[model samples]
Target: MLKLENITKRYELKKKTVYAVNNVNMTFHKGEFVSILGLSGSGKTTLVSQLGGLDQPSEGRIIVNGVDTSSFKQQDWNNYRKNNIGFVFQDFHLIAHLTAKENIEIALSLSGLTPKEKSDRAEELLALMGITEQRDQLPKQLSGGQKQRVAIARALSNKPDIILADEPTGALDPDTSVQIMEILQALAENGHLVIMVTHNKYLARDYSTRIVALESGKIISNEEVRPSKQYKDDQLSTDKSSLQFFTAVKIAMNNLKIRKKSTIFSMVSLIPSMVLIFGIMNLIFNMSGYKADFKPLLGDVLGKDNLLYVTPFEDEQLESTQKTIYKEVNRLNVYNPRIEPFKNTIIEPYTDDAISDMEDIEGVDKVLRNTYFDVIIDEKPFLLMALPPKAYASYQYGVPKKHYPEDHEEGIIMSSEAAKVLLQDNHASVKHLVGTDITFNIYNYKSAAIKLPSIMEEKNVIHTKVIDIMDISTKTKLMSNYHAGYIYVSYGYAESLRERFDLDDFTLFSYSVPDPFKSVVGVEVEGGFLITGPQLVADPLRHLRIKTSLQEKYNLFQFREFDLNMRGNNYSVKHTVILNDAFNKDSLAKLKEYGHVTKSRFDAYSVESAKKTNEYINYSLLSATLIAVVVILIPTLLVCVILYVSIILRTKEIGILKSIGARNKDILNIFTMESGILALSSGIISLVVALPLIQYVRNILESEYDLQASLGSNPMDYNMLGIITAFILSVGIITMIGLLPGRKASKLQPNTLLKHE
Candidate 1:
């Protein structure tokens, strides 16, 4: 039962009020076929909308089963429309994308029936409407009368208490109109209230047990032609159902199918972003050399961290205001122990006592002392490093397989580049250079600091046999100018030259240190100690005894000068101390009592510096990736805007769905799912298309850049996780963009939407 008490609906045009329905009072009972007949603009439709709860009257209360619905919320109104009333529009507003049976099933989806039950119910209703043969046919494929029958069946799907038909047969032929009216009359006979609004008097007169006439905004007449047959009311079913997730997905897929061109276009729009993201990730992985099997060439040169380099220095002072002041040095100066003139000329080389003291350090595995000097070979200056024959055996870069140099032998090893420079005319192969005699001229720095070029005094001339020519590319880090020329000779020959020149015995003692990256120990020199590991730039020595003892033993009170053949004007008394792999910070501090200590070329001390450099590189890469994402957003933003406009254009369809028992959340799910589907489809297709393109690009790079070994050599090189992450992120963002329009469409009233349609 439904009742209207003084219901009024008003509209304002140009500041003048016009009433669509005014002061209407009526009541209708179950099992009644009631017809409201009026000319156009007679408020019949507005009154029906008020009864159906699709629109609220401006002034009055609609009473259903003795409950006033005037103050009902929007959700309550929706529930009322869903469970209590069914609507039939003039144009048969069935979803264009669904078949006749599917359209009915959509309404049945709110019946709380299982999927199979809903299917069975839809078939039964379709058969009852005499359109069972057209169940699988779309709305456009059906005849106009068939479409109207399907619309009526869908209206009956929920088993509502009231059927509100707005011109149910307005577009049908006379015979079809008769058939439609008979259906309504049968529903009334079956204990359901059927109300129809029509402009045709003949149809109304034939179908009605009661007739109500309206003129302008007021009801002019109400009359009963015959007493309606009284029947026991068939109670409307109260079961409720919600939109399931899979059902939502199916509905979304159907919508996408109906709009094929738009969906394809959306998918195609995402390809470029996907390809660029994948390609960049691949490049980063390759450049970082992340393969498990790859090892750096530096590892071969460093030889497992068992060597250390030690350089000694002399302290300096200046008199200021009649007081002695010790001068500080720059910490960042990688080259330390500045060599100066005469104040401290002679370097007290590490004696047997000093060597014993160094070997006594905590982690001293073995100590090998060597002397290095600058010599002239064939009028070209080259660095000459002299070490014992045993030390030569430990050389990482090059050691002769045959004819190895002995301790007392006069054999020398020269870099291939240095030999080429020295023997310009007769520079043959390494085998030819072997057994060839080469002379080295050593300057007498112990003579005097001459003011002018009076006569450069030559201290000693030594002739030696060339035993080997080595390639020094792997030892580049050991040289100040990595590509500079150099030579290697035995310690006995160097000692003989030193004796003849009357020069200071500048011995270099080396040992090893442990955990090279974390060690902070160094021997105390003039101003500061030479750091053993590359981890630190320059840190002051912590032990005072080591500093004081080193200063006293090395006679390092003032800086000294030495004449280096190739090295222009810089001077210092340099000594080296080697450490085994067992040295710790304490061992390094103990060594500081002798002289400034540094790690040798073969140590792993530079690992820390390399790690820091990698960290900066990673940060730069992250910044680049962020910039790339922002660039990708340009197109993503465009897609979002387009999707919003597309949703806004479908407001009428949204209203139709709501009228058919779809809740706001259901409406929201439909649109958001559509966007997600678009994003996912695009992402998947783009990834599929990118794999071959990436391979092709890799091939091109390998051939063009000669990087075959570096580009695609590893099988575990794809960015699968990154690709999946991008897809999810893209779908989420697009779904969020659809929310504003989806919510707006869902909140719209059915009557307002139908009026526009």
Candidate 2:
């Protein structure tokens, strides 16, 4: 059944020649009971390994059933081992986790037998070996002789025609050795060839039909105590196709079998992968979170129209902010307007027909009259206006400054803080101020208080009922300063005062392009001057105060340097100067433009701080995520090293498979299958624990952050793409690790290995 012809195997030592198997020549016939007798390092194990196709000669050919087994590819050799050859090691190398029955079943399963068949054959093999009663017990629970019996059962699972035993009874007592020898002799008598290598000459002489001898890694002699018979592969019941598949699976099983500890070590090495995935997912969630900011809120308030907010410059040049605003501006859609001066606060045309002409333009909602003055409130000055009450909603700070002073009148609202100062002494609160009488004095009016000097009041004063005092500083800074205080009466009240005072040189008329925030649907004003002197620009700035005052005091409606934005609808203003505030988000954007205005709120807060905050959020998240990936890289590398060492450790077994005809792909499949199983299973377990681990670590460190964190409380949204990313990265990383050993395994000299084994 097994024959070696002038087989020579050698190894190089430092300046020394060594022969592991030297010129070994031997023959074993079918049903031959043979033992190759030698001491340790006597080339006995090497010669037996060759007989089993676990090794090949460096200098001679090996024949099994008249086939030159040395010429077989890895796959062919593997097939030969699975169906034609059986091996029994001295150590009883049974898998610890599998039961005694299951240990045999593992062999049958790799032989491509169906589950039912594997179980039946496992039972049959055990029964034949007289270990049927111990089938249910694990290897650890079995005695030495019993374990050897189970191993013999496993070797018989494939129904091989020949069995090669390497010191099969080495670990057993003399009694157990005799028992094992008896079993081998019985199998040989049953027309199966059994060859063994051992140091026990008495046993070999007593049981083997033939005996061969070797010494110092060289074959010394060969003899037949009993007559040899021709051998055949008739005992193998498996077909070629079944054997091929079984060969593949058998090689695959070796990855798990021979590298058990390394597989476990490799599995436990994935902890960092688990931790990294959790941290990365968390960083993504954190980066996606955001709080409401004024810029976006202003966008909601103004719609899609491009609005530029400009106020009195502090550190920035007025023109520079204008350029900055225009730079970021999409000129085509926003129509990019710039700050320009106006000729008049009021247009003069006292006649009804002239007023009708002012009302005729398709673009001009009105060329109505307007006036500006600085009024003293809480002893501080605020921009005040005498305009039609219906048009008063255009003030920049009016939304935040809108307040109804106390004491009922025809109609009126005062800035909240301003009203507080007026109804009290030294800005003190007046509990009864809401309904109390309030007064105003004018130099050119009748109710200006008779005996004025005596009472220290003006003569032409006129007053109206105060409606309600309100806090309008919720969205703007105007009310935070005492200057927001004002005494606002209706535009009609101003008209009557002008009539009663016999006013002259005043024409309360609106001009071109007003309303700083609402740019479209308003008259066009022009700007291209570079006026330098303070006094020269002061009057224009005073006329421009309508724009500048709102620019400084409030940011209710957003603007860039020289743009206004409005959308939706505009209603006639009544009491509230903040008519846009009264509307919902949509309606507010369509706010009506006043006949005159300018940019009022750009660069209001810390632009640098906002920029810094944005940068910090983005870069911080990215850096943390990258660092985590790098940190987790250590375990991945460890797994690779572990797998590589495992492959090297099993070099001798790999050679065994190659001699039997496994392929490079077959070898790779085995290793990859082993690593792939561990990686995939560990990946699934890690992913399952990802979010919880994140939460656990977060809870563990929650006290460290200034903000509250709860692991985002969202399901991990891993899709096919993410899984594929992980698989590709893991395989790529691991394949690189497995490559060197895999190449070495692929390049194994099968003929040389067979002789050396």
Highest TM-score model number: 1
Q: Where does candidate 2 stray beyond 4 Å?
A: 217-220, 228-273, 281-622, 638-757
Residue range 1-757, candidate 1, lDDT tens digits: 6888999999999999999999999988888989999999999998998888778999998888777888887767767777878888888888888899988888877666788998999999999999999999999999889999998998898888789999999999989989999999999888788999999887788779899999887999998866887755444433443566766788889878877877777766666776665566554444344221112323322334656544354222112210210122233332234432322433334565777878888777555554555455665655676655565466433545353466666667876766765666434565578778877654222221111111123444566778777754422111112224457777677666555533222211111244423322345544333333221011111011122332344322111112221111123333444456678989888877775554422222233333333444466467657765774676567666666766656666776777876778888888778777777776677677767777788667556543323222332235455456555666566667667666766777888877664
How far in Å is the alpha carbon of 397 misplaced in model 2?
37
- The worst-scoring run of ten residues by lDDT in candidate 1 lies at 535-544
Compared to the true structure, candidate 1 yields what TM-score?
Answer: 0.58
**622-653 in candidate 2: lDDT tens per residue?**
87667756755776677667767765566655
Model-by-model lDDT, in order?
A: 0.63, 0.52
- Model 2 gets an lDDT of 0.52
Top candidate by lDDT: 1
lDDT of model 1, residue 356? 81
Residue 579 shift from truth in candidate 2, angstroms: 45
